[model samples]
Target: MREISLDRLRTLVVIADLGSFAEAARQLNLAPPTISLHVAELEARIGAPLLTRARSQVRPTAIGETLLLRARRLLADADLALDEVRRQVEGLTGRVRLGASTGAIAHLLPQALEHLRAVHPGIDVQVQVLTSQASLAGLREGTLDIGLVALPQVAGKGLEVTPWRRDPILAYVPADWQPPARVTPAWLAQRALILNDSSTQLSRVTNDWFAAAGLYPQARIELNYNDAIKSLVGAGYGATLLPQEGEAAELDRRIVRRPLRPGLWRQLGIACRQEQVERATGYVLQALARLRQ
Candidate 1:
């Protein structure tokens, strides 16, 4: 039997993902013919046609889909082996691609990253701000090493999730406006409300909180970034609800954060592929756990 090559397997995975040999070639920095040859070679070795090519697109055949699944695991294990060697020889020198929600990125990850950098100087971290759904998709697709996301997440097969923190969702109103010690959904519904964009889980949670009380406030504006939302709140455009980590001193002084009447909270946590948890990623997880403590 002929031996399979990791390079060819990686090429196959990329081609399957991109659905075009030309696009895969561009991504892998190889010629289109080279990609085609790799696929043809693999198909010959496996004794079956792996992909169905159309005029404009390509899709893996049934057998190809099975192979693609194993290919991902093989590639992941091979990378893990290399990362392990690098960690032992050079002291945790590797890259960790982290996905996080906007609120978590803005308030939570900075301190954890600072501690990681201070301790493991060689570990490089790249953060992508994404919604919980997008982050989970990235984890499944292997684009993200770990994700900090809002919880009640449905952990798919081969994914591990752990609680990180429970941040209280607070209402931000103009400093001059007199708010009750505990702001109620009804009370908030009477005022102009700024909220997170509909694309975010926070927005859904906020909407549910109001719906639970049978109140749906007309949102004055929907902004995605936390800073922008706070700026608008401080400018007195409207009151907005957001997750708060301790005191948000960064907000404009003209805005004041008031606790919600029912004390709504957003649960946050770390998620990673089960196979990816024993390397530099493990160290980062430890740091995050310590920070939470």
Candidate 2:
């Protein structure tokens, strides 16, 4: 039932950063005893020792470290909330934390951010590469303001999902290698194949495609990065299934991309907290839409 004081939480963070109460007090413009009292009050409220005092340094206990982590996030959110209010009054100028998959980061975000930067120079966008599931978890935890993830994602409560684009999965082979007009699972099975690792949703979809055709290809190599897979394929290592995206001329010259017989595709979408669908987060979605157009 006791509410932790923001001032005391901030004091705890400063001490953790400086590793000395004296330094924390100097930085915070408070006396050493005042800093110590702030920490002590927090410890008394939490019923745990927060710091270990040594000859010259102070460190947080395990429980203190845990609390410090939460406290930092809480403090950051509070700061961002104030910043958001100021930005709303002074035009668009706030931070948007975005989580996305590797492909989305490599192929999509650059263009989206380019458009966003030109339009809203004040808004700061922070992007992290993460799997769809991890991005979803980050959205739920309030760590990320928006997510660009593969579609067919389970839209549980509190999320607003918008389908963005559908990228067809294509087979990348050596330029010199000749293949059917429309590649088939049977055709791919006859040769060694470079594949996405089993951890990815793309790999799972590819596996199902192979299963439906009653073919299990020899996986010469499994990697998580599209560029790596393309490099290997270009070096005559093996063919791979990858989303169709614009590539560099060097990669384009080395490999030939072909569509599959049945046409497999991966759908990508944007997700955000339902309540955040109309704020700075929505600005990002609008930028992405412009890129699509």
- lDDT tens digits, residue span 131-249, model 1: 88888899999899889877788989989888888888899999888888889999999999889878777888999999999987779888888888888888988999988874447
Q: lDDT for every model?
A: 0.86, 0.85
Against the true structure, what is every candidate's RMSD?
15.4, 12.0
Per-structure clash totals for the candidates: 0, 0
> TM-scores of all models?
0.68, 0.68
Q: For candidate 2, lDDT tens digit of each residue in 83-124?
A: 879786554877889998777788878888998889888888
Identify the candidate with maximal lDDT.
Answer: 1
Error of 1 at 260 (Å): 1.0
